[model samples]
Target: MKKKLWLTILVLLMGGVNLCHGQSLNTTAAEVADFDVQSATSNMQDLKSNLDEVVSQLYSLDEKERGTDNAISDKYRATRKEIVNVIQTINQTTDTIGEQLKKITTYKKLMLLTYKDIQASRSGMVDTKQYIEDFSNFIYKLDNKLYNENTNTIDDLKLMINSDNIPLTLANDSLVQSMILQLNDLMNNFQQNEETQLETIKKLNDLKTRTKDTIEQYQTEIEKLQQKKNYLLQFMKLYQNDTRQRQLTINNFFESTKGVYDRTVELVKDIKKWVYKVDFDMERKITALNELENDNEAYPLAWPLYPIEQIQTYFGDINFQTEYGVPHVGIQIKAGQWTPVYAARDGIVYFVADNDEIGINRAMIVHTDGYVTIYQYLKKTVIKPGDTVRRGQIIWYSWWEPGTRGAGFISKGANLTFEIFKDGIAMDPFEILDASIVKDKEALPDGYQIKYLRDKYARPIDITNLELMTGTTLAKRENQFLIKYGVGVYKQVAFREDAVKDTNIDKDMVICIAFAESTLGRYLSTNANIGNVGNNDRWDRVPFTSAYGWARAIPVTLNNAYLWAYHTINQLSRYGNKDGNIYASSPINWQTNVLKCLSQIKGYYIPEDFPFRTGPNPNINNPTPETITFGETLTQ
Candidate 1:
């Protein structure tokens, strides 16, 4: 019956304990321990009662001997006194044991509570430490970015701050607002990041303080419990070793409740296991902020692929519309048909899927930036989860071409699709990787036409949404392989002579820009948006009557009139399209691509391992070759 009662009591107490942990641990471990100890009070009382009964019987025998002391009073007076004294001493021992058991129960209660409290303290400590590390790393990266930008542009920033670009009237209010929006995006993100760091620190400090206090409290309770237990154990041993019968009875009692003792051992074991198993999630909490304020593109994370690679597609902006849904959340970089992709930073590989449902192999590695990088469409991957990789280790190689059924066709041909994620939220990889390194506008084949450009793009018939400009303006051509303009004819064929006269803008720059803009006069649109130098915002065109008219308006006329003077304030090197997307932030890729293409235009070089030589996609064969490598410079 007592065993059943103990089990019921223990079950209820444990239920409350589990409940406490679940519900923010509103009830402290101390409280729950005290409640459980109450169940044993009745058992202790019963044991005391039996002890008292045994002592009372010994007193009754002594009293009976005293009753017969009339005649034998003189003779047995000493014996009677001895019996009374012995009985008195026996009663005192019983009382002492009763008190000791009371204290023992309290000590046991305390030890149980201390065990639970320590686990809680440890959990809080680990959680707080992880959170501190996460926030620190995030804030450090943000600070680094700010330092880089400020150090480089402190003078320019000061000048801009002092300059009076504001309008007295509302005529240029929108323009000023747009400029503010562009600059403030970074500042606001920085401020928010700092505020998050502050909040994280507060949380970390509170948790640390709580953990420390909990440990101190548990230590005090345990010390008290241990001292009391030591005294109580010594007191109990006196009765157990008093006589053979007493020893036998105590032993039997212990044996009877042996199951309860075993259960308690198991309970302690369970709590130990829980302490080991129930780990707090160490995921970075600053992940959301990282995505929101990814203005720190110069985060020192190198590109997975370098100079030859180009970012074919960007994050967000899927379906060519900015309405809703981020279907494509990362960028794709084309390194070549068969080139190795490197790790962005030093980290461990966490996922590797070979011949997955996507048909292409893929790998995901956790980078030091607290984000996971996924490289898909891989032909070969060597590392697996938990394998450490260096910053520039070749983690995988790109496939020959995009998977037929899986990824289908990558925009810039056989390429590696790279993605960065933090706590399941996808981040823009280009924010860390150099977008220009992967996307050099100048690395295009000059004097070459992209064949099957018609087949590659959907026909005008499928462009049902072409509402404003709906008329069919089919292109005309004389030669399909070489330079061919539409039936519209040339308005002004003054490209080479004009380019030579304007020494500030080289022929190579002209050719590279023209080729890169619209695939050497064959854009995706059948209308041939050859000179993709249209509206600064949309790149939408005022359609040209002839290719020469388009070239004359942008490259020839625009350069001569305003842009191409090397000594002038409006140098073409720093000049971008009308909207001012600078082409010279990091000019290695641009200069290299342009110079290489210039060599090709001069029949100077060609790579034997070119992928597009004989397909419907003809090589830009306007007498162009790949004679020069990137390091070579063209002397003007």
Candidate 2:
């Protein structure tokens, strides 16, 4: 019995020793695995940061070129090339990391090893410090290399700029002109390069396959270890004569193992957070670069629509006969019913409405470049006055209308009226539109050849309604909103109210003018029934204009408002105080100046006796002092 007892004790000791050894091996593996993952994550992050810094530096150099001498511009170009090389290297590294992540099975093995090391540590096992040191050194080397490369690139840039025969393209132009162009070009290129770098960073951050798989594997292993530990505790308790001793050992093991698992989780969380930060930062930088690029004078047009079809009429010198025997100044095109009308350029919808009152449905867009386009006789508009429309975006649709006079004209069906203006003066649109888009059609009933207009068709009023009614007031207040919504009825009021306290203009005068023009929103009728009265076709008349919740008016009316305001300001400045103040005693001055402004503005809209009407018309009612005072309060 004594011999058996001794043998049993020996066997138990041996078993414990074997378990400890195995656990130690596993622990070592786990630590190595953890180090590998962390190393890769850190390397990728550093690479991304370095690339971002390079982009930022390049942008700065480009900005400097704008005001600097030709020598400085040349220096910037050379530095840009070196930075490009560094970017290429970073991209290569990112690709390597991505490839490694794809082999998830290997990563899983590494994770398992890390878990084992943690388990072994609980048994008082210790790993060599050399492993950790080696990893730290590896990361340090990469960082150092990146730093040196960046420094060299920057120094080279400075040298190039200071050297003779500056290689800058700006050196070829007049000194000042060359510098300006170089600066602009640099800014554009910098933005483009930054965007590309951001795309690459996004790709690297997206590498999740291996990481996810490893996480899952660690979870499975942890569960299994927990079950084993529980079983061992239960078995030891049952066999030990001294329960306290057995309990203490089991508790210690539990604490140590849990600590290891917890630490692993924390590391993973940190890596994820780093990736998110890097990604967000890159995005922000890209946005800034884009804004900088847009500030250049030769900035490309925001809207660059290619004509889908040919123009049927050219703007200017139109010979169409009106009911009163007056000739028109705009051109007209024949198109298929429901054909999409696109903005000729990125601009605000100036007017959009059914021409029923005038026997046509049309849409118009006003550009920041002082150009305006009109698309007449539309079935529907898809954009609003204040909406910032993109290039080539469909603004409205066209529909067929019956011809009033000639035989061939009647067969033409749907026709589009197109017009262009520069600072309120009508100009031929053919010069701006690409000629290849125009198609030749049969001669008109009036024995005239169809003129092909080159400008893009503007959206009529229906689309403007959609834009104004779709969003909250706050969203509509953004700069993009101003670009989309041109100066129209409601918008005009908003603009005036906002500008009332502006030192540039008189608040009372602006309010009075708006009241006279639109009756402070009371006279403006969006309901198609009351506003559009001429054509019976719902799609062809103002009555058919979209009743969107914001401002229900044709796009053309807003355009006219702009024309009116421009003329009003121009004429008023000629007579009254050019300081923008209007006094009660200045009524006569206001009237005279207003008449002159109207005469100028009306030239584009009407050609016959435009300044003098045949019938007697009453003067616009002036606002009382009380009403004007209240208007001032609203602006305040």
Candidate 3:
């Protein structure tokens, strides 16, 4: 029977060798590895239990005859030594052989599962090759441990289990029990590690599948753009330069190019993430992949607007009807006009639109880890599409109307509608915000409340609250302003500080004009002229070395050419050189809008600080610029 067992084991080892050469682990071998050593442990457990029973029985018999004998028996001494030797052997085998085997088995199982996931992805052979190498090494080590190290240990255990050594002393039995308990603990730890690794592998497989789908979608989009461009090229040839359709065709071509470029950029970001995964160690790789998977469905890490006074509407609020006339998809926070809003997380601006019906200014940002945030009803947006924003960076302001009561009379003040999306599905803000809105009252500053009053039109309007105000000197205020809303060249702290100290013009006037003209550098010309300093025709922008250069030149340039501009805020209407020689298309309210922004900065209405007076409306055709203001118009 022993000969037969040896022969069978030899055949299995040979088969395993063949399989290893072919770069695959043998399932029969793995099963054998799992079950083969368990019998040895079980035999050890039985022997230890039997020895314990024999020791108890012998102690009872010895207690009854203790006075009669009174001397140690030679048989008892020999048996004690033999049992001591066996217990020591058992400890050694459990510590070295049992521990090694468990580690190898656990690691092999992890590699196998990961190998299967990689294979199912239909990846190339190169991806599976490393796992195959690992399997081969583990199998070799396991074989050596089983055949070489476990051979003498198993023989010793068998010899120690004879009837002669059954009557072990209490001390010997104690040692045996301790070793068995230790082996069981090691086994439990091994099982837990295996379970954790398996869970991580499952998450990694899901992430790989999602990544593949996203890449395919990008490819499809690029193909569509290519087809559109081809058709436009044919259309352009017929129209030539003389036709009005010529310019339209060129614009279509540019749009197609931009679409392809954007898709490529997004695809590259995906590739980089995959490369990042490959750079980590095996254990770290598993942990990182698990985290990446979780992040894909995680909530936003920051609030869209800080220190909000009230939330008027919550996500999925069925009782309340939003301007869209549908179940609310996001929460609405009531804020004072031009209150600064920040990006919820690090992300690239996906979409930016001005004058939307539901919200005046709207933005949708897509984060790297599968989160998307939407901000609507903004009075102004400082960031542009494709711009990367950091978490907590200012991107826009709350919606408000010009020429209205303290609170926006027409638009109901600044109502910011915020939404968070995970994996393209809307998530309840309360879940993502971790119920902070309800339980975390400390998140809001003291006295943070919106005060309301009735306008001349008998409508409730929000007036500016003190919490939004800042009290500081002019130079120091510019630094805070740049930090809160600055972008492009305007973001340079040292340059802004120097300009504020050196420029003869009012620092607030330059900042307000820059915001009104280019949204604080969002609409700068290639020359970085943030305020569109010189080139008139309204649409053209003159270049400057830096925002500071344009700022310093503001007073000089206006004083030299359009000297009437310094006379009053309305005189600056000639700066843009639009129709009827106005500064902007909405010429009548431009000065008032700038003055209101300045007042918001000062925390009080201070229009006279600019030393300017209102004049006749400079615009030609438009009688009303604020008539169709956003947030007031609710289009679903």
Candidate 4:
């Protein structure tokens, strides 16, 4: 028996060189066939459980076919039938693997789209929540601004009434005449109407309260939606895990075939070596051909400002001035006038200075990572020293000579000088800002919007709030203004665009109001009061703490008047006067003056005439363009 076994083994190695040698994965795939989901798990599990028995059956079939004596046809047929059974099981398992692959692919796409939807919805909800927050904040802000104006005016008016300024001097002008007539009327029926005016005050606060509730409704809905989105995302992740397990099972099924296939190839290789046909390491060579796919790495940074000049000044070396050798200390980023500069990183403002000598205003900030980001040539710095600035916060407005031909600019457009310092050494910002190293813009797959993980997760600690508003410190007031970036910043709200979108106020009205209130921001020249005026009646905006905050308050008050009093313009006369607000107090010449100011601003209505003054007629119940509430006209 030993002699027989040795001879058999030697023959096995020496013969069967004629077996198929050139094998392909596709050829093996043909043998295995497609997979189906149902019964697939059982099929693979059965094959795995009975693997040894299946192998023995296959060898028995081979031996029956290659036997020396007159073969027993019955035994051969039985052996063949047993081998066919094992093959059927394998085919069923392969078919199951195919089904799993298709299912996994479908699931992957579904999960990807679901995750993307969640991401998109979350981003949008965050923005909507902010709008709701702004609406809520605007209410108390409006109340505060209006209350201060009203109380201060009443105090002065009481003093004047007791003093000897009787008849109110030269009260012949139509506006003043109207006021005097109302004052005389009030003197007679003061007690009767005081209750009515107080009722009006209640309605004002009530209207704001209702608006606040409406905003809260939006908040509630967004929160619920956010929760639902999160749950769906979690379900998708679990489903993906299940699919990955199925994939591993399929790979296990593949491994079973690999062993048998390798044995067959080994026989061929032994024969080839005996014949000296070839000497290749087929396993290593074939394994090398399998390509491993890599997951994509996201681009980690972004451009500082959205809209900027195409050609950015290189960071390392540059000459801003050849003759003066101005030693360009940083990269110059060119953007148009009123283009707000955002904080590139979360930081605290350290040093702020207006260098009139160099015609440059700069704000220096120290970041949490010990890097210092310096912004130069700023038109204005909203935050003061020690104020924490959030990433993407609008810290400064671009310094640009609007309506003038200026020098030292690219394409005659002003540039913001940006620099980064680490360990007291200036570093090239392009090293971080440029996405080319991580992945070039063109290199990204088609229809892909690459977003940084950092961008998604990096959010600042909430320090921009009423908690900082002590109604005293200038820095604290400025901090409050800075927090309301979209509504109060120089660029985003340069013309108060955010408020205009959510209110009845228009750009034309803002320009006019700013001109009327602060002489178009000139009042801010001494203090931080913008486009405002106080005739000791109802125009002082002292409680706001900053010009930007004061400017934002204008729209809130106008919208409130539209909602509560149904009046479009300001009124100071008695309760029944529709045009009784401050706008009507300028002797009807107010419109002409407002027109002049509106025309001077960059974008506003022509100064041909004042459009919304329905003189002596109440402003409420009149839905005219530029005066009507946005709700009454086109919904913005």
Top candidate when judged by TM-score against the true structure: 3
Residues 472-576, candidate 3: write the lDDT tens digits.
644455556666777755644444435545323445666777777666777776566754455554455556765566666544443332232233344355322
Off by over 4 Å in 4: 1-303, 318-329, 355-358, 401-412, 434-636
| Poorest 10 consecutive residues by lDDT, candidate 3 | 627-636
Local distance difference test scores for all models: 0.39, 0.36, 0.45, 0.40
Positional deviation of residue 344's Cα in model 4 after best superposition, in angstroms? 0.9
Clashes of each: 7, 38, 2, 18
**Residue range 1-636, candidate 1, lDDT tens digits:** 223433443443344222122112222334433433345345334433444454455455345434555233332343234333433433444455445445545544454464465455546544544554454344333323212332432244434543573232233434434544443454344435544444443343344334434444443333323322332233234333434544443343333223222432343344333321123221332233344222322234556653343456667646622322235666666755446567765565655666433233566665444466767767556576656555555667665432221222222246677777654456766444433222233442221113113211322112222222111210111122124321222211223324334222333344455554554565624243453344333334456555544554443332322222111111222221222223232223433444344334433221111111111111112212221111012101
Ranking by TM-score: 3, 4, 1, 2
Off by over 4 Å in 1: 1-298, 320-326, 356-358, 402-412, 439-636
Q: Can you tell me which runs of candidate 2 are displaced by over 4 Å?
A: 1-313, 316-318, 321-326, 354-359, 403-412, 440-636
Candidate 2 local lDDT, 220-284, one digit each (tens): 33332232233322333332434355344334433332332243334334433433222234334
By lDDT, highest first, what's the ranking? 3, 4, 1, 2
TM for candidate 2 is 0.22
| Candidate number with greatest lDDT | 3
The pairs that clash in candidate 1 are 310-438, 311-438, 604-627, 605-625, 605-626, 605-627, 606-626
TM-score of each: 0.24, 0.22, 0.25, 0.24
